[model samples]
Target: MVWGLTPLFVHQRILPVECWYPFDEKRKYVYETLYFIQILAQGQIGQVFGNGSGVYVVLITLICGQYDILFCSLKNVLYTAEINSGVSAELLRGKQLAVDKEKEELNQYFVSKETFENLDNLDQRLVKRNLRNATKDALNECIRHHQGIVKVCTLLEEFYNPFCLVKSLQMTVQLCFLVFVSVNTTASVLKSLNLAQYLFMTLCELFIFTYLGQVLKVQSLKTADALFRCDWYLLDLDIRKNLLIFLPIAIRPVQMTSAKFSGMDTQRLRAILTQAFSFFTLLQSLT
Candidate 1:
């Protein structure tokens, strides 16, 4: 039930084009940085390991580190949006003030003294009433816009919490697995020679690989979510300014799918599964 509903929520509503950032130089910076960090971490781990198992451990470490970076990037984008919204509100207020001044000035130029006083009093009252109404309307509009952004951010944050919980569980399971592997490896080494050195190596391998795998998984989700959200936001704001960039980013996923799940029914099921599995797999894999 949770699986079926979540995807419908995400794909049909939450995961729309309006939720992403515009694909531009800013986005490119984030993408490049995430890619570079992932690669560099992986490369370093690869160079440090000598055996196949040890190398695998390093690969996992790199993956986990990459995920950390992704989470951080998404967090940054959320913060940026919050800051931008505040700035936009201030700008709107300034524009309203300028408009009000022009309206007052135009009224002053057209009327004579005594007649103007009565007219002025009546006009002043009307202007005040209208200004109050306008201010309330503007405030409401800003609140609505800000509320939508906040809703998405809150949802993303909720999504992240489960990922963290899953990662912790996975780490605990991996540690137990490593201990079992280490005991077996130690027993074999003790029969032939001293076990201290081999035991240390086994422990190190277990820790590094387990940490790496967990981090990588976390980062992948983070990066993908950030990219998705950023593009959605940009597309929502001004499609014309960013449509060319947004369309490619938005449509790329649809293009990548095989024909098997291309039909409406299949696609619907796939989306449901995708959301359910995304939530489930992240948790299960960690466990």
Candidate 2:
């Protein structure tokens, strides 16, 4: 029962179509890979991940390629949500500034025209600066009221932590096995080619995950910059302190991990590819 239902079960329960729908071609890896996977499923082919790739090269090629595309599709979509929300916050800040300027201009009519003209140039400059800062402070308060910082952070952490752990485990196993296959001189040409294809897919997936993780980190840190950009310097000490409450947390970067341990960044991805290639070279030399 489980064998017959594996494809449907994985699609409905594990990998939904909606996950990949939001991503563009740039974000979605290798559309042909997904197509091949579906073809393998429809043909009722034998398992690909089994030890006997030499006996089932066609099935293995389709299976590995398809699963690779499936896995990488959502790495960007998951974090894009947080990034968009942060951008919206920045836009709100700019709008608030514009509204405050209009209000100040409206209030200027109350000041007597003679009194405003009589002020010295230096005093006028200082008064203008004070008005601008005060307006910004009020606007920052409104921005803070609307921010969902806690909610965004919580959801990101909850989703990223466990997802990377499972991916790391699965990739680790695939990497080890691929290396083993590469070293086996007795392996058929078709077997070697299938292993190489799978290795390429694995590398692509790792690159996608780490790249998206880095993007997420950068986007989250930009929120901190947005917070600091506010006119906290001119507000009263008490009000300033409130504005600063979330600033420190915002400044701290958000990161996704590989297996709940090491950070998933481009640096790590480079190391992985380097090591995989180096090992492949060593095995070739031995052969």
Candidate 3:
């Protein structure tokens, strides 16, 4: 039952989908469908178990099942909200870039065509001053939009902390449960199955699934972080040039120190490296 529900929960929470319909309409459909399914499944499971005296157990199970569905729905809603917020940030960034580009193009057009060259000295100076003022105004507008993007990014980061904490806690609890079950199962089956073989198989399966989950979580977080970090404000020429020179050197020590502090746990270190490299590589590739 848990295994079946886990995938459904993850799918609902993590899968990105476009909702073209009205929000209330889509939400109503989701709520109705999930509730109906939950009712049907709980009835079937209880009937199959044939344990009528286990009314309290059945009620608890039903409640938990419904709670999980609700949790998944909430997660989906939050995910969509974050994406929409990030899209607003992207729009602001794009608008700022467009304004800057337009100003640059206008300045270049005037300069290359020598539109002010034929004018008297005073006239040329006046034209140049007007162009500068216009450029300044455009830059100010861009800055305003960029500030909006920054605020959205900060909010997204704050939102993600709670989500990541919840996911990590869920994973930890699941891991502990698996360990307890495996240990108890192995002990009970010692007479029928070889102890070494049973333990090895169980441990292998646990490690595989846990590692896969960690990988998925790391990838998702890295993608979201990269999206949030996508700001034109960091693309100043001086900063970009210096970042290239400093990044390799800066990242190496941080990676090494994190690994050492982690007691050389290769799995954990590899996960860290994956996230670090992903961010750095994204920054480098964005030019």
lDDT of 2 by residue, 85-201 (tens): 232344434543555433342222211221111222333333223433444444454344324443554465566566666665666566755886676657545445656777877
- Top-lDDT candidate index: 2
**What is the TM-score of candidate 3?**
0.25
TM per model? 0.24, 0.44, 0.25
Could you report the Cα RMSD, in angstroms, for every candidate shown?
Answer: 25.1, 18.9, 22.4
Cα lDDT tens digits, model 1, 83-176, are 3333344444454355443334222211121111122233333423333334333333433433343354345334333433343344344444
Pairs that collide, model 3: none
Candidate 1: deviation at residue 67, Å? 5.9
Q: What is the lDDT of residue 217 in candidate 1?
A: 33
For all candidates in order, the CA lDDT equals: 0.37, 0.48, 0.35
Candidate 2 Cα lDDT to native: 0.48
* Alpha carbon lDDT at 225, candidate 1: 43
Model 2 stretches astray by more than 4 angstroms: 1-150, 186-192, 230-238, 270-287
Find the candidate with the highest TM-score and give its number: 2
For residues 94-177, write the lDDT of model 3, one tens digit per residue: 543554433432321111221111222322233232323343333334334333433543453343334333333433444444
